[model samples]
Target: MCEEQTVSLVDVLEEDEELEEEASAVLGGSDSDSCSYPQGYVKRQALYACNTCTPQGGEAAGVCLACSYKCHEGHDLYELYTKRNFRCDCGNRKFSGLQCKLYHEKDAVNSQNKYNHNFFGVYCTCRRPYPDPDDQVEDEMIQCVVCEDWLHGRHLGRVVPDCVELQEMICESCMNKNPFLWTYAAHLAGPEVLVEERRDESCANVPKKAEVDDVIEPSCKRSREEVEPSCRLKVLQASQQKRDQSGAVFWPSAWRSKLCSCITCQAQLSAAGLSFLLDELDTVLAYENKGKSSEQVHQGHDPLMSALDNLNRVQQLEIIHGYNDMKTELKDFLQTFAAEGKVVTSEDIRHFFEQQSRKRRRVDAGPFYCS
Candidate 1:
């Protein structure tokens, strides 16, 4: 466990490129230049909601990456990131006058597709756009495991652990709606300990890895041996108030496995439309892992190896040397910016090369003297 460190949104802006890299990781380097309508609903793919076509408070519409470029170029768009089991809604009735150029025919509606406030370009209980123009407060946005909607840390009404990725979060609404989870989390939750603290002002739009210090073990963590299986649920229900407050609940990884899957519990879970809770693949982490696996299948080898395969040994060695030189020099040059926490720009790269060029020139023209 470590003390939590909060970073502002302005610090996140520096990671625009990092956001793209993270998206690529989730997308697994899928070709986004072409339309994806013909493919039907992708298991998991990068999604964008065109605000220009489907405005907020209206019909929610999402488009695949290719459609975002070809169908709604220059349109106001919300990067919904990657979503599971979604198809392109670009040419549908939601577009009104527009049709997807890549695919002429698409179903008017995708029944399996899911939508949240994110599709309308708003998120969290606050119902505001990310980096909200009206608000200046800097905070981290957390995604609820149930809704898949991003919520600000402040609005979560709880402390976000440093290692959030390692833990699973279920919002208060979801918790209350499915109170049975309280029993499972209490038994499976790990202790969040206080330790060395570090802060990452990285990409705001991406779910980066962090640490956890506190677990969700509430008063419901009584010894099961003391109570019969039939009476366990009642005891947990009665002791639910032992929790501090109604806030986002974090559980250790694999907490779902420890959840009571008895007939009664399953019946209750199914009644609440949460049978997916017991499914291992239902989690966002599972979706991301699938994306990564697909990416690995799509990209069989490192890009450098692919390039080297086409080159002669001499050319390959030359390329490797150049790469090494650039890597070393760039790292040395960027150390100053890293220390200062400055955002490096294209101009900075150019300036670094210029400095390198000058140093190389001075080295080559050693022992120069004016007589």
Candidate 2:
């Protein structure tokens, strides 16, 4: 019984080694053959295998996907699955989807999960078949994402891979036919002409007429040299309207008309309009009645307040002028601040004068009052 058991164990070991050898032979073990294609590939392709291990009779049957030589005739290509020698006839080192069942767990819910299976596709890494993937898989074909159609990878360059959870089984040809679906940003039509037309029309009312001849010539002029006064008014009115519509037009000459259309520009113009109102507030706040017993602060409000309250064109101009004056004053204030290392506020100026008055009072003993 002991002798018989030993012989059976030896036979089992021999069978295992034979199986391992067959597995290696199924994968293209030869380093000389390989294939490559740049565009990318997809297919029910023959996996990478070792050319050295492939049998002579197998060469004529189902050709290597990498080299197009049928090395396995009667047997299915996927039967040669194994741990160390997992590869295809094309010399692809990675397992194809057909053989994926043996080594990879199929994730029905999420195929993209790399942990599950390499459902994304196979990559060629065959050392024996140096450029085998190129030689095995046809260059013209690709697995379409939309439809599972095998198409020339070159022709489907226009198609963008959809960002879908499931692989796009449909080919590029089917995608082109669908009205709802189209190509990516690169394939979209040219500049939107309608949008451009709308923008042009927005500033269409702003009249910027060409300059007419300034000098009046005599001696039977061939044509009348007078321009319409109304036309000039229209131009001025347009300029003002454009300014009002867009805000201050200060930019590249081409952009000036469009500048007023921006919301920020409108807000800026509105803020500038408040300058005249602030000026009126200042006049009211100023101290009046310098030297007389009868002198009193003006109880009645300034008439300019009423004008400022109403947002008329004249008020806007006043506001603009005031804004310019304030800008100049601000520049002077900034210079003073830089030199002093502190901002000189209105309260600071008033307090300074108050201190001067206190010094004068301390020095004078007699009743010294200035009217």
Q: Best candidate, lDDT-wise?
A: 1
| Model 1: residue 334 alpha-carbon error in angstroms | 4.0
Which candidate number maximizes TM-score?
1
Error of 1 at 7 (Å): 17
Model 2, span 264-290: residue lDDT tens: 434543454312211221111111111
- The digit string of per-residue lDDT tens for model 1 on 104-194 reads 8788888878898899888999899987989889888877877778888777655677667777788878878876666554544433222
Least accurate stretch of 10 residues (summed lDDT) in model 2? Answer: 243-252
Model 1: lDDT equals: 0.71
Where model 1 places Cα greater than 4 Å from the true spot, the runs are 1-21, 29-43, 190-245, 262-268, 289-311, 333-371
Evaluated at residue 294, the lDDT of candidate 2 is 15
